[model samples]
Target: MEQAEIGLIGLGVMGSNLALNIAEKGNKIAVFNRTQEATKKFYAEAGALQSQIIPCETLEEFVAAIRPPRPIIIMIKAGDPVDQQMELLKPYLSAGDIMIDAGNANFRDTMRRFDSLKDSPLTFIGMGVSGGEEGARHGPSIMVGGTEESWKRVEKVLTSISAKFNGDPCVAWLGNDGAGHFVKTIHNGIEYADMQMIAEIYGILRDGLKLSAPEISKVFGNWNTGRLNSYLIEITEKVLAAADPITGQPMVDVILDAAGQKGTGKWSVIEAQNLGVAATGIEAAVAGRILSSQKAERVEAEKILGLPDTLAFPAVDGVAFLKDLESALLAAKIGAYAQGFAVMAAASKEYGWHLPMPTIAKIWRAGCIIRSQFLDEITSAFTKDPDVANLIVTPAFAALVKETDGALRRVVSTAALAGLPVPALASALSYFDSYRRSRGTANLIQAQRDFFGAHGFDRVDGVDKHHGPWGSGAAIY
Candidate 1:
């Protein structure tokens, strides 16, 4: 029996782990790296795992070793390296061969590559691999953008290596051109908003109540048992509770407040602005990171104008505070998801992808870095109404917000009174309020438009008139 052959280029963290995963699944793998030492190390580690892998000395040797109808996965850097790798492989690749780029390349580049390779018999796929290093070793959520014919040929391998989300494999053909990268970009955006919201909660607990990291961690752990449970929150609790190896204090205290952001968060915010979708949570999160990086300004403020000391909430009702915090967190989380979904919807329409929103939700339920119970509700929301404009406006979700909004407001007000920063969460609630009350501002907007555009105005009874410069109303002829 002839064995299936797969080759992986660029033995970096993600590539090496993914190569091991594929080899462990009983397929023969030909691994290549720029440095022979790195390739040898991968071979050693994978060999220890009893994997069936062959480390090739050269790209030519690797290509010659692979079997016919070859599927070669490229996991190198996104930009020029991807093109260079493709150029190197193009000569060795035969007709009907497959090439998959699993890096975080820009969608435009992917589209360009797709067009460039169209005339050739060789197949190209722009695939999105999520869940980080751990997921790469185990199973990550995979998004492929290519022809159905190519997807069919490699579907089994993808399914085997993809994480199971709600009993289905997390890998799927996300339409043609740039769909995979587009979805992954939005996924990272959602992750940014989610992480920021959790940080805001931590700030609220630490600053408002003067609680230690462990105390706030315990609260998060408790919340994990309910609907508020999520991957981000779960990881946050671990971060808070983890003690430093030497100092024995919580590890979070030693970490810098400034967070580094990859370009995806900025891309999402920019795309949202272009699409005219309200992505307040993600935008605020990005802005917060920028402000954190301005440490010199902050230090000057602290020295010249003393900042307020942390305030302590009354110790009489700890449970009440916890409940309020949980409610606020839930509300904020929903708003973030809503914003992300809204962006997806707009992108789908703009790009003509017709992406299945419900499927997107279901696939995000596991394996991916952003996996959470909240996705189940989002899936349910879209399943019930495919045309549902926003997740927050869904009947059940609206009821949830109605029940929790008061608590969220109270928490934000208390944080303000205590001079605590809860920027991400507060912004989420503000967006929710703005979205829900959008209908109420139509009259105000109409008046402003009449004042500027002189576009005429309509009365409450639906009578239209053009008001002249003197404010004299003239009926339309």
Candidate 2:
């Protein structure tokens, strides 16, 4: 009867594998679930690791099985479910024990939970775990947010279980409270933009260029050997290459066009808006997802509006077009990364998270869905100037922009003329253009605002706010 080193609640997919991951690391773990069945099933199929699992049917029993100053990791659904579990476990836990929540939860909620738990000795931690089911079983990127003392208690164990980027563990203790989740939310936002850009490229290949799925898959495979090498690209290649056995058609073609999300992408846009940061690429990506879901409406609308048939695709130079497409993807990817980190910077300031953006880039170099060769450059950029406002302004990225801006412009204009939608990619370019301009046409907008809404406009001196002469020249509200 060896006592377990840690307790894990929730025997769901993430929880079960994480527990096994802990067990595989030679740390005995106690596991529990809402029902007895999930726990029973876990142990029944635990294989060689069954001996390391301490099956606890009750919450009290689960707490009792863990060693003193217990470190309990909860993998339950975020929001209300976490509160429910906390309430249930409160009666059994002592003062010094810490509860770690490893979920894709909103950072604001995590902060509230962290604050509320301060009355007791139980420390509440908000952590982010990325990498899908397979990564969880093996090694995933980890971000933890808690007090220094709390991190010290379990730092070694978490570091040993996380994926390593060039021999460095992809786990770090960010600022106290919600910093980890804040960073993770931005990560997902960047992922959304990346996926949207990739999908747009796929659409261009399939519909605009009239390329076969296998042909497009070959292009993706080739790209994987270059700077675009990443987990998502690798999976996209596999998915596009796979053929449906039953229909003998491309597997992706038979699947529904609608994309579904679990709220993180939308949350990213909302948070960006709240921070008054320009994350237009993320906004466009989230909008693209919503637009994709209206399949029935789109079908009817297309019939009524008489959109051009996709058959009239332009005959373009294959080699030249692919080169431009690659450049466009890279440009758009840079814009998205810039915007996502901008949002993170704003959130860190507003919330006092003091998040280390460079370390974040380092951790994301592997394990995460957005892991890419691009991150190595980003890590180097941020390490050089940790307080850099925008990544596009960095020397490395500026050089990249100089190299690829034409191709990005070419692809966007081409897509527009070809009647293909490239919302995310277009937004990326628009944001970049707006950022680089010394003076924009927003003064006219301010004048319009002053005329209609009586909103004051600043003069050329960048000083005096003055009301414009509109009819009566009234400043009256």
Candidate 3:
């Protein structure tokens, strides 16, 4: 069999797009799918391209089709299928060959796969591919986890197919063992939170202002020009403006409000809780979806509550509302990042993977779905001080928070009075307040801790005394 420079398995939407992308970048590729027809169709579509690409009849044929010291990218579904694909490719792969799992596999599974393949000469990589099918076809943000040697082998291919973020390659050797998927898991979690926040904004506009979709689209478009500018906001404008084909009405009304998450969001929340980090925004977003799914309860709410028909905003005070909304959104966004970075920090300590938080933020600035202007500030913060505990503590962010706090509080209070749920915004403010006033709740928590764990409480005046461990102690003022 003729040897190809690169091999790609699972010719699905993402796989096919990536394979084509590699081919376009002047690399010879051998492509395979479970179904022969899919592979043939892809090759046929490749047609008269300058870059050589061959379709393989089976997994065995595909493996044989690649050269010695081969590099194969697996784009199969996560979980059992990843293992099955690895098994199928193992026989045909030789020593020094490298295999990359480019799916959303659980980080634990990646760790297991890495351990299982450690003794063998073949190398394994868990890669995180972001930017959806289109990004895969062109250039996507790539996060890779493997040994430095394995990364060196396929680094060229990865760099060639990755997008540029802030003048750096979006692709990076994330860290050793499962870091790639771990980061991707968090990425998806952030995506879930971002989408939900935007949905909440849409609800506020629809239910509170009773604005038409086009009007809402205009508001979002204006938002995209400011600090709130982000991929989610950009898409929100499009979603609002899009007209329904059948009814000639805004499609936003026809779309389902109940968002469906694909588990990563849940995983992030669980992981955050385990690490004892406050992931209020992500958790609230996930909870918002659950609440949205209660369609019957919501219908009953509309009937029983008899929601106001019209919401009034001062005609001359448009800027005030926009500013207030922006402040609220910014506060919420900061809380979300705080939660995500806290997870990264804890995970870094646990896994011994020193992930560059700034680089992660920079990579998300473009190509990825959650790209935002705020990332520039995050990247700057990390550049200035890599070990900064939280983005909220950064001087610039702190100043911004101070300036926005009054407006954010007003907006949240108004939303609450109007019977609108702004959980993400409210949670963000709560996190901010909690962090800023840590001393306020520390006493109560210490009392509870002493009650349970018999942990000695330190006096606010810097006096410390040891009580019998796990023994009941009187509260010390």
Could you say which candidate leads in TM-score? 2
Alpha-carbon RMSD to native, per candidate: 3.4, 1.4, 3.2
Candidate 2: which stretches are off by over 4 Å? 309-311, 463-465, 473-477
Cα deviation of 314, candidate 2, in Å: 3.1
Local error of candidate 3 at 106, Å? 1.5
lDDT of 2 by residue, 1-477 (tens): 788888899999999989999899888899999999999999999999999999989999999999878999999998899989988999999988989899899988989999998888899888899997877888899988988888888887788789898899898998899888888888999999999999999999998898899999999999999978888889899999999999999999999999999989999999999999999999999999999999999999988987765446667788999999998999999999999999988888998888888999999987889999889999999999988999999999999987889999989988888889999999988988999999999989988888778888889986675877678755445
**TM-score of model 2 vs. true structure:** 0.97
lDDT of 3 by residue, 347-417 (tens): 98889889988888877776777778888898898899889888789898888888888877887777777
Write model 1 residue lDDT over 89-119, tens digit each, in one string. Answer: 9999899888889998777788899889889
Report the CA-based lDDT of candidate 3 relative to the real structure.
Answer: 0.82
Q: Note the Cα lDDT for every prediction shown.
A: 0.83, 0.90, 0.82
What are the clashing pairs of model 1?
none
**Candidate 3 lDDT score at position 273:** 90
* Pairs of residues at least 3 apart in sequence or in different chains that clash in candidate 3: none
Kindly report which residue pairs in candidate 2 clash with one another. none
